[model samples]
Target: MSGLQPITRSSQLSVEVVWLSAADGVLRYRSEAHPLDGGVHPDDAAWHVSGLTLCTPGALLHSTSWRYARGSVVLTYVALPDPDPHDTVAVPTDAVTSGGGPLHPSPAVIPIEAVAAHACRHLALLAVTDPQVAAVAAAESPLWTLITKLPCAPAGTLHPAQTTATAPHTAC
Candidate 1:
């Protein structure tokens, strides 16, 4: 124990701001990275980052998942903008990969694209099941459209087209 080096790791907050182009129907997004401030809770950090970076803070901001990569435990969040902005970093939905399922016997390597897709899929489920989330989704046209396009899956599998019967409760 004396000679062995201590393991070092950091926590990160990864925010995915997803929105639809009002005119072209293109789904655009921006992925932001921030340090987890020791003074702030991860949830509060995610919301603060979302509000600061987005043109308009989304009505629906929620933590979607967490992953270990690059020597850090990344806390991923999904934020949906209420009013679509003119300029947004664009990534096609097809770019999102279905590379791994959560329940696979062996560890599966997942890419950032799949993570973003999962975030959207999580929100889509919330919109339907949570009354508060449903209201927010309904108020924002672009957000609602982007959400509807996301795919869902049953308890075991991960697919964009299907949905789970129950979803975790959301704060929004």
Candidate 2:
């Protein structure tokens, strides 16, 4: 999907995956990663991230972005349900942080609530909100943070125009 962005608060993610072209096909692996902006921090101060690496299995790539708005964070993924009668891959804590690796050995699907909660937690982590804001954010269903301000280019993913708008620094 070109220019496809998921804005859902509770959408299930099958983990960010990396693929290696093997004799059979593309072997996929998953990992645990925080959003570049720590989208789940939920505090009241401005949050900033200089760089973030989304990793899986045999490769590493930097996101096209560096700085993200409090509202810009959204959970995005491709979820694949398990295929079996009664096999299940236990959700791993490491899976959330480093992302899951290898195909799960059972058959199961992620619930929408799980997706929403994770998205909420992610936003909370990358966020800086006071008690009041935090409470509201926490209570917000399909939780998502919305930010409004003059457009500030993300650190790494700044649009070319944004870069051109800045005056070159001349030190005396």
Candidate 3:
């Protein structure tokens, strides 16, 4: 076991960011938010979703999504471009701290596809190792089924998306 522990729990979800000592990297998991009796927006129904973010020192690596439906979870990782200037939210630096000096450099601009692929590989590991995650994968939720097809990699093997190579990779 990786000794996963919760670092924070907000009203919406619980988050964990842990160092995988054996893999020499980090793994983050955010639990799905509980579904409201009806939905957040009646006009547009909302389903419960969880997220994961993976990063190494000096970079914001990848982001992933897990959507809950039909008593199962659907997983997807996609590279999302930086938020528009108008949509940016300011974070108070004083409220943030990390054992690792600084995990991301200012103005980090990683490609979305790379982030997605990297997230896929990590999700694959969780699918096999974590019972909950495995159940989700086994359910084969339909979200992103037409796209984001990701093959499982050997445990502990870093995918190309984690490398600095410039070649484009498919999203997961």
Candidate 4:
């Protein structure tokens, strides 16, 4: 076969998707990426996900999960959004230093589909690079999976807790 086409890394994209239960939903959502600013949401899927990780604050209340699938990975975490009503901040990509010092592991959340695709692309490299990772392919193998799979409220939707009416995206 001819060389597989490269994955898009552009700042823009678009696609339609089906949003089922936030718990066990698989989707085909298309994303539109725009060069991200400080506080606004990402228009692109990759940026959107990475932005999720960045917005998710590291905390004592925060937890971790992992799923070492035979050929895929999905990551998730509890995030703390920006504090002030208009507070736009930035965190380092490699490592972020908090008032206390460098924070602990900040896991990245990639959808199962993305994970599967990555595995297909890097199978050979992965086989030789990390065989042990290949042995376990369950959705609950990695710490990030636990963090992501935990049944949390959906974005822009409300569940059983609060008394006040917050915005849709504030569903926590």
Candidate 5:
């Protein structure tokens, strides 16, 4: 019975993104609030986000990218704003559909460097906000171990000094 444990899907598993402003460096949880009130726009080049998606059997997806000079990250797939008409060519009116129409574009790929950078920031935030979790993370906990194993996460990114617990607490 101690071997491999049976896996089950849990509806309680969920995911959400935490956004940061590239302009002013403000942090906000993504929600229904208006962009002016802390919400985020998918196409806004001035915003970035970091989040985790937990799938069945323990899969995790981290959304982050390094292509932008400012280091932007997006958690979900989004349709980019259309290009300016002046930079486009007119399509033929006689075009026919193959099946229905064009397929949805794939989500943007995030580089490991960006993902690691964001994860480090999130860990620091958690340490500051929750002493309990911070204590666990600071003790070389499994969660911290998993973060260090991320294929994209660079070495020394999860150093103890960076993710150290801010509040005083007994070691577990």
Candidate 6:
């Protein structure tokens, strides 16, 4: 083990999970440290962490995207924990903009809020396109409401800080 050791993508795999819950007509989210055990898939790790973090079950766990950050390929996930707030923070749905540039050949630095926001936007897309996801969202009242409230635009189409309240959803 020295300074010149090479690294592969799999060697640096890790998971980062955002706990999201809808309350009072808005989405609230929180994230906690999740240490990974070797040989566990990132998505499964996210589910395990979510289970440990939230007591109630039935939270929709989905892997939205991956970003390179902190010297590792971080797989991001969102878990919807509702009917049991669990001290989450509220973020405006319109803050769904990526923090930095695209991760083509460089790692982009993204904040947790932005990550969670992106997750919500991704789910909103699923809500309309995927039948199974749509059914799940429909069953969850709060999740469905928040997903409906969000502008149904594919990721990267909407500009940053676009006021969703005044903007027309059809434009998305």
Measured by TM-score, the strongest candidate is 6
List candidate 2 segments past 4 Å from native: 1-107, 129-172
Q: Clashing residue pairs, candidate 5?
A: none
User: What is candidate 3's lDDT per residue for 1-172, written digit by digit as tens?
Assistant: 1222323332232211111111112222222223343234411212112122233121121235342233323333322111111222221111211122123321123232333334545555556666655644564433222112434554235468854555555565
Best by lDDT: 6
Query: Could you tell me which 10 consecutive residues in candidate 4 have the lowest summed lDDT?
Result: 14-23
10 residues in a row with least lDDT, candidate 2:
42-51
lDDT of 2 by residue, 12-112 (tens): 22222111111122212222323333333322111112112223211212121111123244223311111111322222211222112223321133333
- Tell me the whole-model lDDT of each prediction, alpha carbons only: 0.58, 0.26, 0.31, 0.27, 0.30, 0.69
lDDT of 1 by residue, 7-53 (tens): 36544444334333334565666566676767778878777766634
User: TM-scores for all candidates?
Assistant: 0.64, 0.19, 0.27, 0.18, 0.21, 0.72
Off by over 4 Å in 5: 1-110, 141-172
Model 6 residue 26 CA deviation (Å) reads 1.8
Provide the global lDDT of candidate 5 against the true structure: 0.30
* Candidate 5 residue lDDT tens string, 48-95: 322222222222223332221112222331111111112222222122
What ordering of candidates by lDDT runs from best to worst?
A: 6, 1, 3, 5, 4, 2
lDDT measured at residue 21 in model 4 versus the true structure, 0 to 100: 13
User: Higher lDDT: candidate 3 or 4?
Assistant: 3
Query: What does the lDDT read for residue 70 in candidate 5?
Result: 19
